[model samples]
Target chain A: MSANKSILVCRCAERGLVDTDGIAGGESVLVIPDLCRAVADGDPMLGGAFSEVHACHPRAVQSLFRFAGHPLPDTTQVIDCRCDGAGHAALGTMEDKPPAWYPVIDYDRCSSCGQCLEFCLFGVYEKAPDGRIRVVNPDQCKNNCPACARICPEAAIIFPKSVEVPINGAEIDDEAAVRANIRVNVDEILGDDVYAALRARKQKRKALLNRKKIERALEERRKCSGGDQ
Target chain B: MKMEKTGVHGIPSTLQERDSLRLRVETYADQQGLVPPLSMEELRDHALELAPSSVSVDYVMVLLNNAVWRETVASIPYERRLLLLPQCLRDFKNCPAEMDEFGLLCEECGRCNIGELQSLAEDLGYVVLVAEGSTVVTRLLDGGKVDAVIGVSCLNALEKSFPHMADGAIPGLAIPLNAGGCIDTTTDVEHVRNAIRLRSDASWVNQVDTARIREMVEGWFSAIEIDSMDTRTEQIAYEWVCGEGKRWRPYLLACTYDALSGADGIFPEKVRRLALAVECFHKASLIHDDIEDDDEVRYNAPTLHCQYGIPVALNAGDFLVGEGYRLIASVPSRTADLMRIAVENHRMLCVGQGEELRGLVDTPPFTAAQLIEIFRRKTAPAFGAALRLGALAAGGDDRLDAALRRFSESLGIAYQIHDDLEEYRSGEEHDLRASILLALANDQRPLEWYAPDSPNLDHVFREMMVEEKAAQLLEHYKNEAIRALNPLASAPLKSLLRRTTSKMLTPAGGRA
Candidate 1:
């Protein structure tokens, strides 16, 4: 049954790293590390593995398939899932997780107008069981879709600064060895004094970052203690 | 007067007509010493005086555009010049390129002259756009990034953009596309190159023939000469060094030294050694880089590691690097200062490379800014070192040293960004290892497109946007490099450095 279903390949879902969640249950979703590599290798068996393959970037997929030595199967579909909310259901997840931006209502300035609820098409808002409008599905709120915020007549809505989500589980391989190689290579090409100067600049940057971190922590502590009063 | 010289679309267009018009304009300028910022009425009168009865209004408009802009274009800095090319210049059938909001993303496959023109203009620090009509011209004018324009388009599009240029008071020279079907059109390539190199000091054009410098540098690595030292390693090193490459680094070194000393002849002996040393270092880096990246080919030949095996290649690379240092040490003038520059830049280069390698294991979603920072660190230092070595060889003072460092850093980053754009256009491979396009795509595109296992995306709009941003950044850095030259008192050296900045971006055979 899963083999008969269409599998959507959303490339931007995880910064082109990996998206295991797109493999829903037993659905025949194949996650290739790189389309160019897959097409270059041209595994003939791939042509018949799935009923349909929908990709966010169809042109690239088509080019890759062509490069792979065969035309994309008739069942292949390319969708415009960039930011227009198309083919999102098949992809099974939104691109930006932990949603970098969401609407926040200011109760003090609010006149309790329901304009935001009407304007939002993504079901990001709902009438609560208690009959008051509230943010029920914040995850459904598209990243940087500020239409609802703009349409708010009361001007009570605000979006916080977008947080830069660090890539998870990413680690530099043998940082010290890499650095040592760099030093050795540089010393060989330039000379020892150049290495010393580079080191000094690096140390200065590190010290500045450390100082900033300490200052931020101290400010946070001060705010926390001040709020206690 | 019959309109005998008409185009396919009945527009009065012919090569002879255009040439005669250009000849008259040049004659007028020569006779009258007419610089740009001329009134439209004055330009019209001049055109009428040249060809009162036969020339069409379109030809007059073009002549006017040239007359009103030539001197202004010459005076404006190269970084402030924009080359507006029409999409029709592209090979319609063979081009696997796409259009963005700003313009066409040229693949630069050399299928058409657009690639050559774009490459040349960009090398000269000109912002090149492959789009027709007035839209981008108006935007570029309003943005204030471009001070002058050299546009190639049909008469229709040129007329459309004329009002916008006039209103903005922007100096512009328009070269009408040779054909008028708006697809697969051609332009006089020689004329375009001449306009691009039209600076106030025409004598500066081809002042340092890079080909000559390359030939001279090649002699330094002669196998016979190197083998005379009686060592197998020296022979191998010489062979590796003498292999086919652009030799841009050595050229930069020699150019800088010449600019500083105001010497118009072959580099003196010490400067030659210094220039050769710069190449040795660059070639050595390539060898080790190939091994690290596991690349098989370079300059269309087997990489050092691939040819000689990793151990021997590594040793050879190390030996070349040592030779670079030795060469610098052997320079007669201010060897200590030269060594300092070489060592410092080498370290910076390593740190930059280390940062890049470190990124591989975790493969962080680097932003464009971060990638630019890496470019600055890794690529800029080599250029800086080459420039400083040349400067020091010419007996440059501390002030020049500081200026060269700043200038090279900016030039280096801009150069790398330009390379990234070129690589993206070539579509040879989808290697986004250190690509600014990928960084911008990651930062701007929706989350779903960021998946590690995702297919290569061809979002033309995003690519164009990123390219626009990168061009702005490139312009910013180019200006910074120019600014760094402000401290220098010597006018020739200043002009030479400016010309060098232009030369650095240009590929071989880019100039006329």
Candidate 2:
């Protein structure tokens, strides 16, 4: 929760992602015309990490660093300046966002089982000729959904913007990965689907946004479960 | 850097060229027999191979999904389909359109094609959504109100929505905008026109009045939930009856009766009594299951034991069991026959639960086969009773009862496995500390079973393909459930049973 003065701002003017003068340039503040192109072009300016990043969404910026082979540490804070500039006095979150939500795979954890590939409907994942699975279309991922993560079996899939842990790049535990019982877990999700018998069942589950509470409860339950045993 | 409206854009900008590209994609799709939900890489790879180098993958992906879903979309009746248009298609400055929760309310303004397409689609009974994003589209689909969708959107929007349609296996065709920017994007009107008018002989399937039948069942149960009760125990029993249930047991009974007798309108009084009996049996089991498992919550609320003490909850459960037998015997004409069905299922349920409960003994390690046998007695009999009672009420023969028994066993076992996996995954409280996943894992690798909360357990479960093996077992039983229906000569029962498999088990249940 402490602040860092050294900030990098990506105007991202090409897609109108941020305001041209959202920030009043200072000695520690560096303003790039577009961070997206900078990442794509392997700009040397991105060689080091920044404690504070004034960009679009925190997730988008983190994803850019993740894909660019220099993942931001959990300590870094990203402030969205698409609507209002990340002024030295005020660094508010991006209120109006474009479609930048996508999934990032932890290849170390992926087994190429193709479960995520079969589970996804949006064609976000693909199987290579070598049988390795890859996130093919990250942009097509639904915002705030970590369903693929839930069914990953390996807990490899992460939604950078997700409010849930493990899914949000935190550590996994019994609460996040384990369930009360396999049958009960399946029944909870599937039974919720049944109640909405008239609609798309999984789709309802896909956009279930109040995940922070459920996951927190899961964590507490896991610890208690361990203690009770 | 905005382009002129309806002029500058990439990827087959001309209507003629776009149409030709659509034709080529359709031909290529036919050759490959490509089924969606197609992965982005697959769609991109196929599009690159087929379309000219000038065409974009975004353009081709839309066309590719459209080509594959063309037949399916055509089969869905216009009433069950939605024609979605973007507001950017409107000449917004002059467009006289209002918006609603569903979509744009068009004023038939001549300035834009939004009016034209909306009018044509609405004429054919297609639900029209002239809006941005797909929240409403998702809601309509989730509600099971619409089965198919035809939409014109920018590639970016289509990319986001593709998965929802493909995942549900709901047929859809999307046309990407070829000209202009987001303010006033332009799509080929001909493409929109053709998609709107799509129709075939298979456009609809005639069926009984199921929506109304569900309505009647829901209405009756709701009334019973709040009906005046003299005793506190009766009040508690009825309150539990209507709480957080799909009323599947009763619904199955009604559907079975309908299929057997071909009754279209409201059900008779005798059938309703039998239906209530089926639910009483199910709810009673839940109360007991809660006490046994010590689960604090059910149906997203406090369990009966949690709400009341275990003693009162147990009494209410027993009361319901007695009520079930009483309901079945209320009609004296078929009391003996119906009572036989009720008593037998009740005994089977007790036997099944008895095996799992095991008379307060220490937890026993169970083989996969033994666990499944428990499901046969614990789960299947209730569903079998529901179907059998409906059939008996409709004057079905014993031959039908035999088929129903086989069908329910498969369905119940599958349901149990499904519940088994979900409950395990949920980490909800349960007296049975065993898991099918752990059992399957132990069989595969011969590892000592770890406690449920161990991180190593999950890793081992994943490493040994625990979910995959269990899913296979689940799928096998579902198929077996379907096969059991083949023996029935009754067309209505057979057809209803076939659809029931897909309806109940199909969600996130691969290949259901």
The most accurate candidate by lDDT is 2
Q: What share of the true interface contacts does each candidate keep?
A: 0.00, 0.00
Per-residue lDDT for B282-390 in model 2, tens only?
Answer: 9999999999978998989999998999999999999999998888889766778889988989999899899877723543356677678888998899789999999
Model 2: residues with Cα > 4 Å off, grouped in runs? A1-229, B1-81, B85-113, B122-127, B131-136, B145-247, B259-262, B280-351, B359-364, B391-407, B430-434, B444-512
Question: Model 1 segments beyond 4 Å from truth?
Answer: A1-229, B1-211, B445-453, B460-464, B506-512
Best by the DockQ measure: 2
C-alpha local distance difference test of each model: 0.63, 0.70
- Measured with C-alpha atoms, the lDDT of residue B510 in candidate 2 is 35
Indicate the DockQ of the complex predicted as candidate 2.
Answer: 0.03
Error of 1 at B302 (Å): 1.0
Docking class of 2: incorrect
